[model samples]
Target: MVRATMMSKQQIAELVEIARRDHTLWAALKDRELDQFNQDGSVKIPSISILVEDFVKERCGASHNYAIGSLIVALRLPIRQELGLPA
Candidate 1:
């Protein structure tokens, strides 16, 4: 079993900042395809899986599952922020 390396807060923050500068990546975070709407019209955000998959395909060029895992770690902060979670 391969263990994933944890990203430091600073590292996560930096990655988030970098992602913010990328229009495509930032837009993916806000895309409706990745969201679920409730009966009350409140939104339930999907996990970052789709975004990570897209990121890996466009940037990492790695087809392994680990690429998605690594992306989730790197983009954790930004993903949470997009979901309106407290950072």
Candidate 2:
């Protein structure tokens, strides 16, 4: 069973906007986390490092947009691999 994590609609909408604003800005923000489920059979969310707490707070639903943006800014970011499937 592949259970999904809970995601926020508002955050997703914002992420979409961010992607539109800059062509490749958020190209790496796919919503799909690892397929591994928790011990309870629920899917796990992507964990952000403590280094990016402020960025995480600014984002919603694990805010891949914010994380990606921060990564871009730090020049140490990674791209999305979920095939554009945001929460």
Candidate 3:
């Protein structure tokens, strides 16, 4: 099996661009059900994150890997910037 490696900033940027253009994928990412909530009302995506990671990897022809924290940071920073929020 081909093990995955960390996705570079460029790769993550490309994935973000693709997600923006694809309505279905964008929706999936936005779906509340895909997120796991903790008892304190925070996300606990031990499994959910993996699912999203795998989904993105597959979409990008399995080129690179997105660790849980890296994926969250990569995706959130852009949205935060777009919303005029501090990143």
Candidate 4:
């Protein structure tokens, strides 16, 4: 079991960027995607991605990770703010 390590906010930010650009890769991230052996062994996978997508897409009825990832990165990137996302 490959253990997962704690990632810094920058790392999360980087991942947000990566997942935002690559839809396929972003979609691939799942609760079990990370290594099972966490270094701290106290890590808990966040459902933030799914929630972010829903918030961005405004599809609260159905969750979309890709759209969510894009929104997160878009907000962080400051380039695609014009996209049809609620302020």
Q: Which candidate leads the pack in TM-score?
A: 3
Worst-scoring 10-residue span by lDDT in model 3: 27-36
Give each prediction's root-mean-square deviation over alpha carbons: 5.4, 12.4, 4.9, 14.9
Better of 2 and 3 by TM-score: 3
Residue clash pairs of candidate 4:
3-37, 53-68
lDDT of 1: 0.59
What TM-score against the true fold does each predicted structure earn? 0.48, 0.25, 0.51, 0.27
Q: Candidate 2 lDDT, tens digit per residue, 1-87?
A: 444343355554454455445443332222223233567987544432332343344554453333343333232223232343333
Off by over 4 Å in 2: 1-5, 26-87
Give the local distance difference test score of model 3: 0.61
Total colliding residue pairs, candidate 4: 2
lDDT scores in order = 0.59, 0.38, 0.61, 0.43
* Native-to-model Cα distance after best TM-score fit, residue 30 in candidate 1, in Å: 0.8
> What 10-residue stretch in candidate 2 is worst by lDDT?
72-81
For 1-87, candidate 1 gives per-residue lDDT tens digits of: 666445456654555677778887677665643455656888654436676566545553554433345546556655566778665
- Which structure is stronger by lDDT: 2 or 4? 4
Candidate 1 TM-score to native: 0.48
The true-versus-predicted C-alpha distance at residue 45 of model 1, in Å, is 13
